[model samples]
Target: MKTMEQIRHLYSRAGFGLRFEDMRLVEQLSVKHSIDFLFRSSVQSKPLVSVKENVNYKDFLKDDQLSRKMFMMQQRQQEKDLNIEWLKNMSTGNTQLRDKMTLFWHNHFACRTLNAWYAQQLNNIQRDNALGNFRTLLLEVSKTPAMLQFLNNQQNRKGHPNENFAREVMELFTIGRGNYTEQDVKESARAFTGWGFNKDGVFAERKFLHDDGQKTFLGNTGNFTGEDIIDMLLAKKQTAHFICTKLYKYLVNEVPDAANVNAMADVFYNHKYEIKPLLEFVFNAKWFYNEKNTGNLIKSPVEFIVAMNRQFYIDYQNPDIQIQFQRALGQVLFYPPNVAGWPGGKNWIDSSSLMYRLSIPATVLNDGVIDFTGKTDPDDEAFIATARKEKKAVHTRVQTQPDWNKFLSDIPAHTTKKEIAQLVLSPAINSKLLSIINKATDIKTMVIELVSTPEYQLS
Candidate 1:
């Protein structure tokens, strides 16, 4: 049998932590088999279909402020719906690794758009390329309408080049900051001039608007197009190192081991930036399963909520309640805070956010309530506004009852609460919390008590 810690660590990294049935299944497999299973399952995955909302923008395109406002409001609601669909997939989809890696790439190439169609399309792009080669993913993302619009690349032209996309391509997406100079950004922008999409959300090139001139980028002088610039960037070893560092932090631990990152980069670069092999190398590494890496990173709001849903099979009668919970927890899907996306880790937790996070399991599983009326930071007012706009009662309550029979049946009859605790939590349970949990009368109460502890916050 796989050790409880080994199984827990596998689920924690491969996807969210396992439910009881998931644990039972994983217990039968060796670690290598488990990793291979996740990869194979994800590779065969299909794109997620977002729930369609029937809203005709043409009806509201009357060239008036009220019309524009109505259109925007409708789009915003549709975006929320799309987010709910993705959340549902993450919680229950068979291709768990695809969903997890899509989330990783979403933050990596963070771009926000109010258009629901663009948002849905962007999500598909992330999913499609989540396990593919990095070079192809980079090129596809750069050409997408949502990304071009978000970075103002559509405004770029031959004489007046907008450097926003080029700058981020290096600083945020590729080799990272300080690896390339400002001159490189300017030259790269020139090469990327006329890179835009048509109104039908199709990728189109405007040859007349493009600048065809020799430019020096990274000490190489050539008449480079946007594609050429991307090709050159991918050729650098720094790009591999930068990407590997991010993958390490996301999958392994927040504080990356430089040597491990460098080793992974070698494999990544040698294989021409294919993501699957890099992931395989990471999972196969001896250090990845080290005890020090377990429970080292804090769970982001999305991870926390999705894992809870996966474990308990949660659903909200009013879908808006799900959106409100996400907002209150500080991660509104399809609406990243900025271009850099959610900082995650320590940034995900604070006095207000942590209280909200801790209360989620109880609120959903036990019919507990939440109060939002209090003095708060200006930055958080947006979430409060989103909550207020919801037509349903804002106070917390369980809308859908959980099906616990499967989970209960999966556990052995002789298993104690301590053994259950070990399976549920990644970090070792604190003695004080364990003492309190040991007094619980039954398994249900024990679960609630275990999940509510601070230890549960670190997955």
Candidate 2:
């Protein structure tokens, strides 16, 4: 049986699994001390944004047509450059846990950055509210400049309401659909009237455009504003249950057992929607350390990358290569596939992706390269020529000097391939794959094989 501390470390490192060092320390401390340390230390990662630089809402609309177009173009360029810098920060950030949790919130309240400026704002909001209160996080995200623009809440008005934000708030964020009615959505939409981004892409509530009229939402009638609507929605028991159930799937296992979920809901609801309290409850619970929960989840691409980075203390000096590396392996920074975010676990593996994931570590470590040239046709001369050119580019331009010594030093010397495989992969391993690994002459080959396997996708 895994120690409670080891379980925490596994959960943190693997699927936000705990760091082994943290686990060791926690074992000597009280649960209260351990829980406090996790949260307190988890937020050590400095945000990409700083304390100054006020975002003036009026700045958004100052540019005239020619200037506005020019500004927008400039913003795109800035974002491209900024993304590389942010990647560097994420790679070397002090607070790995906070960055990881911020990513978790990003997927939960999904937003796509169409432009650079809005995208940067979206990223900052995620970092700001990552370890904070759930209510505050929800409110900030709702009123955020990027979110308002993304969800079409900027178009919400008293007379002509846009229901996009309201619909998502129910379906994706708060109640997860079926819990709210069409009438409820319609009413909630009205409450959010005049919630929009200003000229500077900062949140601004337009009073003249807002609907102050009495509205009925979820059987409650009043002169409700957007905040009031949020309050009411959160007050619902179903909201607590929804959030708790999702947390179970994320932190424990993909599937939620009824008894576990209900127990979480009871604690979450009783605490007036405090996330930290509920997390403590879950972490302290016996089921979280159950053998079934161990190594059950497949690490998301980000999780996999972060865990590897953490384990090896690896840092790439080139931001572009690091950023491009993730893009090649899938899970590009700041770019989620859709509002639902990356479909994690088994969904991360397919023929195309699995090969890349398997090859990426060696590629990064050994300075290997992959040709993206015309590998399309079996017998096309033009494609063959393109493939040759691309291969040349890969060999020459994407140059890297892999350090095997560092990689070897990172893992235990006496650790068998099977033990390392269990550390990296999940519960089950294929016998055929195991046989292939057994044939690997050395640790490096064995490491590559384990990572290359279908099982490595799991935590």
lDDT of 1 by residue, 85-199 (tens): 8888898887888888999999998989857787788788889999998998999999998899999999999999999999999998998998999999999999999999886
Cα RMSD to the true fold for all candidates: 3.2, 5.6
**Can you give the lDDT of residue 231 in candidate 2?**
89
Query: What are the TM-scores, per candidate, against the unseen true structure?
Result: 0.93, 0.81
CA-lDDT, candidates in order: 0.82, 0.68
Who wins the lDDT comparison? 1
lDDT by residue (tens digit), candidate 2, 1-459: 545535454446323444334344565766556666667766554656421233333455776777665655555446556566665454445465466667778788877765656666667777776766778889988888778877889899989999999999988888778998999999999999999976766788899999999999999999999999888888888888887887777777888889999999998888887776787787778787776776677667666666655544455655355544555556766677777777665676667666666766665555566643322322234445755755332332345444556556655457677655555555555796678668989877776666666565665
Runs of candidate 1 with Cα error greater than 4 angstroms are: 1-4, 51-69, 374-394
lDDT of 1 at 398: 48
Each model's number of backbone clashes?
0, 13
